[model samples]
Target chain A: MTDHIDQDRPGRGDGAAGDAHRAKPTSSAFEIILPALGERPAFEVGEAVSVRDRSPIGHYRVPIYLRGHVGTVVRIIEPVLVDNEAEGYGRNAGSRLHYYRVAFPLTELWSRYEGAPGDELHVEIFETWLERAQ
Target chain B: MTSVHTDHHDHDHDHAAIEQVDRPGYYEVMETAIRELLIAKGLISAGDIRHQIEVLDSRSPALGAAVVARAWTDPDFKRRLLADGRKGCEELGISFYDDTQLIVLENTSEVHNLIVCTLCSCYPRPVLGLPPDWYKLKPYRARAVSEPRKVLAEFGTHLPDDVEIRVSDSTAAVRYLVLPLRPEGTDDWSPDELAAIVTRDAMIGVIPVTIGGEAA
Candidate 1:
């Protein structure tokens, strides 16, 4: 599929040249680390992994959805460091290790889920909440 | 057998009593704890918190409805919207957070975009208000990235199979809001009438707006 890079220049297509003026170089550390952390080694599907609860912060990416859900390890992503929630509370200052692509069975999550037995929801989780599932 | 049965009934009654041990309900306990902390720290007055809740509870759906209506009538304004989402909204007098950035995604024939925080539920609350309960589910987050079409399907939304689904994962730095395609028909309709058809789900790209039973 051809990707159209919409030129921010005004009078090209639309008269408003405001987007061009506001277009800044995207060189933030988050974008830089995202790519690196996205390319981690792969793991086999259905492998078990223990999931645990994480400390709360003012803002967090770990939604309340998978707070206590147990899931299988599906893939291992490149390690990325993010703001530590406990540390953000003025406790210990450190970056937390996290992985991407862990899969959980639909039935394991909700008893009434009627999807196929093999249907799984794969999610990214932090290292602290994971262990080798028995 | 009679002595054993009597002992079992006594044990069951004791268990029931233990289970019934009085404890504050979840919402009450949480509210109390948070209130206590805030009061102890003097961060805000109780009256202030109550007033904030009152304001939040009193918010009507009119503001969002107006924004949707205005965009439908003004082609020039839509151009501005396609360019700068926040600034365009400001032009319509809809003020959002000055601190955070909101990115708007447009739906086209080739690709469809959906937003999910995956890790946590991060919503454009200032514009959209409270998020639906399903939005906070782990299943929604995990499925949104892997199988967006399926997740949307649960919300009674279906796109052409050939269309590529692009799911935007919101983080601390950026937030996303979807802009659905305009519905067909109602060419002669006024802006107010157009806005009436533009639901919040349409703005979030979960559903397309329809005009006079025609797809936008």
Candidate 2:
């Protein structure tokens, strides 16, 4: 666990680095049809979301890079019983909230991103950390 | 380097002269003390610990590969898996050792999904076994969520600029798994043959599963 994969493996990087005009792929998305939940979700799919920029001390699940960023809600995880912040302290007696899968554009995530316009980064953010974007 | 003389060829020389290493970290010492104390108090037996570790070690990437292969061939199973990753795997007799939920992300030409634990190395341990050492390290945890396209390039996965590189950060209770796109020239292959090409990196989303890729 102490070892790092910072360096590339001994016999890898076959696709080569820095190859412009990459070949177009033949396959499409796997396209899994999601069943609807009777219970209403906090935020609907495709809704714009803004992550709160709260700087809480000690154990927290929200990554610093994602704080105060706007994204779209990809999926809503049901049952809403995760308070990993409190659970990390060995106790989970606090109120629960849903963990919505939010998809942020890679360009918005990193300023120097040179990938395609459709590229994105998704993260599971608790309802408390997210609010309806203006 | 030791100079070998032909006169000493009759005796077997010990080339493996490395010293016996001990648990050197503070947590390692603490863990040893607590474990020994617990054993002495008859709380948990050494056999129990060994059994748990064996169970963890036995869980390789093949389990996830099998699920991917099934999804490729069995449309009904794939539908159930995307809806509920835990239940779908459970139907296949894959037992989840923990309570965390597993979210299976489907990869398409439009978007490629990658999993990362920015907060820590949280992974789908029940199916994919332990996370790689690099996965638990600083570089991947930091770069994957930020410069994801560049990170994918490190693994030799050069996707078109139009392809959406979706990086899923396992920051909370949910664990993410990428259901990679079934490569071309694999349509005629059996479930077993398809599974043979589905590798750990493809599942992890660092690389796509190629036609003649190494099996997990």
Candidate 3:
């Protein structure tokens, strides 16, 4: 249906484009750091991980449904930022980390999921909430 | 005591009678109370609040449409956008109001992308402004990840059985925007024309952009 779309165009699939575009996903080439809290990101793309099951009190971003489920890290958001679990309580005093675009099977997310096996539910999870599931 | 005007300059206009919500909901009441208290404490001025509202109201889906149109017309821009959403949007002269990063998800023939904040109503506010009411409601937040196909069907978006329904539950500060597949017929169309056809729902991934009108 999208024949009018330029099929000859490179980097048209999955939005990955190429490594050229992936140089730095930021507003500018150089970012000024106020205070870097976390070390380099732990997990890489395509790594299997699982969400940490513990629930903390007050203003947490992680949904309860994804607490114990396993997922693959599809994409990693760059420039390690303030942890949401910390920021939600009005401060990100020390916590800062990368966010992983974790993809899980819809069937795994929900029992009796009325969709194909290929269906997926992708969620952006913080480094603190994830563990190596390999 | 306030002075009363002897002559009121009320003109009959082609406007429907302004209606008020029957009652302020829970959050609405809290908002008004907090606002009044804050103003009373002299921490914030009413004008500042009004100015903030104006800034938010100024933002709309047009900004995002312009970005999408640029990506569709220019392959390099598309590549940049797919790689880094915030940087690509900034390249187009679109400003970011928030400190968080924006991620642009592309829809392909094999996979369809949908965005939902199962935890809360987190959207690409810098580009598309405020979300619709349904987006913040319980049902949309609850079922969007669990039963996305059914949700898409409700929005009049139906993909082939084979296409993957990839739902992104934004559980972090990072925001999401669905870079919808540009429709076929508008190959020769200008950027403005392309932008005109891109709807808010398209960016939200609930529906695809069509020439005639929105699906169903």
Per-residue lDDT of model 2, residues B118-209, tens digit only: 88899999999999999999999988877787888889888887777888889888887889999887788999999988889899999999
Rank order (by TM-score, best first)? 3, 2, 1
Clashing pairs in model 2? Answer: A5-B134, A29-B108, A116-B161
lDDT of 2 by residue, A37-68 (tens): 32235577788989999898897888888899
Tens-digit lDDT string for candidate 1 (B100-210): 345566677765667777777777665677667877898886777556666777767777656655556664434556766666667788878876777766655566777
At residue B124, give the lDDT of candidate 2.
94
lDDT of 1 at B190: 87
Candidate 3 structure quality by residue, lDDT tens digits, B1-216: 233334435874444445563687999999999999999999999999999888888889999999999989999999999899999999977677777688898988888999888777888988999999999999998888888889999998888879999998887778889989989879999999999999999999999999988463
TM-score of 3: 0.82
**Top candidate (TM-score):** 3
What is the fnat of model 3 with respect to the true interface contacts?
Answer: 0.94
Fraction of native A-B contacts kept, per candidate: 0.10, 0.90, 0.94
Best by lDDT: 3
Candidate 1: give the clashing pairs. Answer: A40-A78, A61-B119, A61-B120, A62-B119, A63-B119, A63-B120, B69-B195, B182-B216, B183-B216, B184-B216
Model 2 spans with C-alpha error above 4 angstroms: A1-41, B1-19, B37-43, B214-216
Ranking by lDDT: 3, 2, 1
* lDDT, candidates in the order shown: 0.59, 0.81, 0.82
Better of 1 and 2 by DockQ: 2
